[model samples]
Target chain A: MGLNTRIEAAISNAVKVGQAKFPDNSGAVPPRLASALAYATAPGGARIRPTILTSVAMACGDDKPMLADAAASALELIHCASLVHDDLPCFDDADTRRGKPTVHLAYSEPLAVLTGDSLIVLAFEILARQSSHAPDRVAQMIVTLAQRTGMPGGICAGQGWESEAQIDLSAYHQAKTGALFIAATQMGAIAAGQEAEPWFELGARIGEAFQVADDLRDALYDADTLGKPAGQDDLHGRPNAVTLLGVQGAIQRLKDILGGAISSIPSCPGEAQLAEMVRMYAERLTPVVSPQSVPGE
Target chain B: MGLNTRIEAAISNAVKVGQAKFPDNSGAVPPRLASALAYATAPGGARIRPTILTSVAMACGDDKPMLADAAASALELIHCASLVHDDLPCFDDADTRRGKPTVHLAYSEPLAVLTGDSLIVLAFEILARQSSHAPDRVAQMIVTLAQRTGMPGGICAGQGWESEAQIDLSAYHQAKTGALFIAATQMGAIAAGQEAEPWFELGARIGEAFQVADDLRDALYDADTLGKPAGQDDLHGRPNAVTLLGVQGAIQRLKDILGGAISSIPSCPGEAQLAEMVRMYAERLTPVVSPQSVPGE
Candidate 1:
């Protein structure tokens, strides 16, 4: 099956697991909590992180397909949870995400908070359950996910940076965006019984590229095109590549990062295919104008 | 070292780990976030859950004290994080916990949320890192913690029940208080290389007993004695044994459950010692005024 199809199926299955496990024998789950979880994850955007993970696993010759799928699903769930929390009123206060109302907007703020917490737990739960066949891999993946998601240097720290009086752009961006990407690459390699250390550079570069792309999109696009609120970084007084480096320089930086990302793919049997995947992502990251959207046509 | 001392030491060490890992090269960790994580856990009350966990591990013949400590610390961290979130404005809106300002009041609402989140992730990270000697055990503990902390039947579900229009007292008590107790027992057993199944009933009984005791305290004790707000269940219009069964009946129920808990310890080499420990807990749960505070004195 195609990678995207596999990811879609995996995600759907994971959400089903979440749904089935959410309700009790009487079929009672806080409807809002259940729905928020599904809404945050369903009809996912791009699936870039999971796709990168799967590509890494495939390049490393994935022998444990189930584990690979679980890793992908788990990473995506974490991403979804982050988005849910990020859109909270205290955070970005975003009303929409992925072209739909954010979890906090669709549900109450408290449920949104609980949903985010539950999703993070669910992500680790999925990984732990899937790694039963490979105990060591599961343990490593748990550590990787937790470290990237929590503190010391995780997404939590990334968010916490916003509360600080000062911010370090590199550290902020790395934890905010790069941590999960690192987890994806590392978890993919671990799932495939490959050394994870070698893939960090590739994941970091890709993450940097993605962040730069996000900055450009936020600065250049409107909410209609982005499917979410744009100009968020500037509004929040948060750090961003575009604001720091200017639009053209940010776009140039993104290209350079993507180039580095492609070159950084660790030596593996499927190196060429992985490089191609990176190239495809690079193309998508570049802004394109459709003919029908031309104002003077 | 004595068990209490060991638990105190372990908790302190875990906080140190949290503090040490929170900062970057700049030695900055959003000071409030770091302090919140530390403060929420310090001067802990009772340490009952960790005590039970360690007791179970010892009864099961734990050889890896480090892993046992890690497991115990992990469960405690989850409990602490839950307390932090539970006291948030949208939830209980508690102003104090354990006789001090709660995380939200002491820090800020957003920081409290992030602190709770970072601690949960930190729990799993501690377990994963310390369980290097037993990968299988670590995997089991991770799954166990996630299950108890997250959805369907976890603490999150328990909290979710509060948001529902209807409430199930049994399910509510089980998840809100019982879940962590069950995790403590099961994780202890897993850490000791024993089957966790035998310990579930014991944990559940203990959990139910603890909940009943809490209900009794909430219904009867003053804020000064309880070190927090009293009659919270009534104040929040939540389900509780005291309200359902009356204070006397709740006390009676607490006694009955304590008896059941004593009789429920799974057979092991240290069965007698474990029984003694349960009995000690039972005595404590029965409640008594200090000798200096006798009414007729």
Candidate 2:
């Protein structure tokens, strides 16, 4: 199967596991929680992080299909959970995500909170269930995921930064957006029986590039086009690359990071394939003028 | 060391691991997040869950100190996380917990949410990091923790039940309170290389008894004596044993369950000791009148 198809299947399977685990013979949970969890994960976009992870695992000469799929699903679940929490009234107060009403809007705030908490736990459960081949590797995968998702410097810490009077943009963005991307790359290598350290820099670079691209989108696009609110950083008075460096400067930075990412791919049989994937992602990250932005004819 | 001292040390160590994992020089998270996490976990109440877990492990002949300590700490962290979320405006909307302002009240709503999220993830991370003796055991511990904390009937599901139109009292109490207690017993057995299934009944019975005790306290005690807002169940219009069974009936039920709990101890080397512990807990559960309650008399 193609990478996208495989990624899709892995996510579906993970969702099934999450849903099935609840509402067993015991008094089942109110169906809303289960449905909300499925809703947050379904109809996913791009599957970019998992794609990067699966590709890295394949490149690393580790063909443990179940393990790779589990790792990819686990990381995606964490990403989805972060989004669910990030949209709450306490955080971004976003009404829409992926062009639909946010989970907190569709469900009550309490359920939304529970849904996010459930998903995070489900991610670790999926990995533990799938990592029978290499228990040690599974242990490492769990730690890597927990570190990226929790604090003192995980995604939670990233969100915590927004509440502070002073901000460090690099640290903020890294934990906020880059930690999961790093987890994706490192976990892929770990799943493939490879040392995780060599791939760390590559993941960091790619994550930085993605954040820069996101900044460009947030500044230049409208909510309708982005499928979520744009100009959120500005709306919240939080820092962003575009605010620090104008649109042109941000675009230039994106290019430099993506270029660095391609060069930093750790040597492996799939090094060329990984570079090709990075190049493809870089192309997508490059912004083009929408019809709305064109100068008056 | 005595069980109380050992339990205290175990919690401290786990908190250290959780805090250190964050702020890894990538511009540390805003210090507030770290302090909030520590603050939520410190000056713990009772340490009942971890103490139960440690005692069970000791009874089961699992002398691996680190593994046992890690399991105990992981369960307590999960319990603590639940309290943090339960106190949020979206849930209980309480102002005080464990004799201090609730986390959201102390920090902010967003931080409370993140603090809960961070602690849940930290629980699993502690187990994975500390359970190097037996990888499979670590995997089991992770699954046990997640199952009790998340869905198809974890603590999250328990919270989810509150949002539903009709609630099953048994299932609600089981998931909301019993799940972690079950986890404590099962994980302690797992930590000691024993099968987790045998201890399920014992944990569930103990959990039911504890919940009953909680209902008694909630109905009978005032806020100052309870150290939290009393009559929360009534205020929220949520289900509770006291509401369903009445004060006298609930007290009778509490006694019956504690009696059953003593009888339910699975046959093991620790069987007698476990019974004695349960008997002692039963005495504690049997409450006495406080000075504040003398007004009516």
Candidate 3:
């Protein structure tokens, strides 16, 4: 199947798994919290991370849908948790997400906070419960995820850094965005029972490339196309690669990073497919117009 | 050493472990986030749950402090995460906790939310890192922790239930307050290589008794003594055993439940000190005043 078709299927599967895991009225939660959780997890997004995870797993010759399901759900949970916290009044103070009111805006702030907390817990729970992977592999995956989600080098630290330090743009983006992307790739390989160390460098490079693309999008894309507010990073004085390097410089850097990511894929059995997928993603990010392009046009 | 001293020492050890595990300014995290996390996890609370866990583990004949550390930290993290969420404007809307400004009140709400999320993830991370335990046991512990933290039977579900449904007071207390208590007992036993099922009933009964004591304290104790807002639960109109059974009936029920909890301890080797500890706790809760004593007077 084409990469887009595979991505669509993966997104649908992720939604299905999330729905199956979190029903509308899971006995202990009040209807409102459950509804909010379901709402937050349901609407399909780009599913880029899950697609990368599944594709890597597939490229490693492991086609178990269950691994994809677990990894996808875990990634989504992390993403959702980040979004919930980011939209709180203290952070971005966003009112909407994916065209709907954000968790804190839709639910009460307390529920929103708890919802994020629960989702983070649930991500580990999903990884822990995946019977297909070895217990040790699962444990390692959980640790990697937790490390990426916690105080140092995790999304939390990424957000917290904005308030105090004059952070390096690369480090900021790597922690806030690239860490999870790297994790998604590594976890997929781990689930496939492959020696993931060989792929770790490639994953990190790809993740950085993806972050640069995201930076470019934030600097240039419209909110309507991105499905959320754009250019807010520059407005909030948060460090970004685009800000450090002008638009053209950032785009060139993205290309160089993408090349490095693609080139780093080892000559494994299914490396060709993985390389192609990486190339496609790079091309897709190349043509997206920046918001600066039409200023006052 | 006396059981109390032993338990206290165990808790101190667990605190050291937790502190050492979550270091300040780990290169992985941005400096600000690291400082915030260190601040959030700084040692100050009573550490009652960890003490209970270590005491139970020792009582069950597992004297290894390291084994208990993971479980202890996990429990505390869950507790800390809950407290952070509880204090947000959407829930109790409290400004203080443990005689200090709540996390949200101290940091921005988003930071508080992310801090809480990090704690939840960290809890699982600790469990996953305990290489000393059998993989199955560790996985089981993670599952139990997740179930108690997630929807349906966790504190999150308990809090969510408050928004809708006139939930039964017993069920509400069991999910919200009792689940962790049960986890503490079960984890302690598991750490000792003992079966956890036998202790589940006992721990749950003890948790219920403790909740009853909490109700009494909330109704009768002043804010200065309780270290939290007095009678806030009643003000919120949430169901409580005290509200349902009345002061006299609740006290009687508390006594009965305490007795049951003490009796439920198995007649096994190495249980004498644990039994004595249970007896002391039950005796401590015996009613001092008649029903004529006004609540919150």
Which candidate tops lDDT? 2
For candidate 3, lDDT tens digit of each residue in B113-223? 766776787788788887445776677778777767776567776777686656645556777888887888888888777787887887788888888877876776667
List of chain B TM-scores, one per candidate: 0.93, 0.94, 0.85
Q: Which candidate leads in TM-score?
A: 2
Candidate 3's C-alpha runs over 4 A off are A1-29, A63-65, A131-133, A168-170, A290-297, B1-28, B42-44, B63-65, B168-170, B283-293
Assign candidate 3 its CAPRI class.
medium
Two-chain DockQ for each candidate model: 0.52, 0.70, 0.49
Residue A136, model 1: lDDT of: 81
lDDT per residue (tens digit) for residues A27-117 in model 3: 3336677677677775756667777877788888765656656766787678877888788777788877888788877887767876776
Local distance difference test, candidate 2: 0.86
What is the TM-score ranking, best to worst? 2, 1, 3
Candidates 1 and 3 compared: the better one by TM-score is 1
Estimate, for each residue in B72-126, the C-alpha lDDT of model 2 and write its tens digit. 9899899999999999998889999989999999999999999999999999999
CA-lDDT, candidates in order: 0.83, 0.86, 0.71
What's the TM-score of chain A alone for every prediction? 0.94, 0.95, 0.86
True contacts kept of 1: 0.54
True contacts kept of each: 0.54, 0.79, 0.58
Q: What is the lDDT of residue A260 in candidate 3?
A: 93
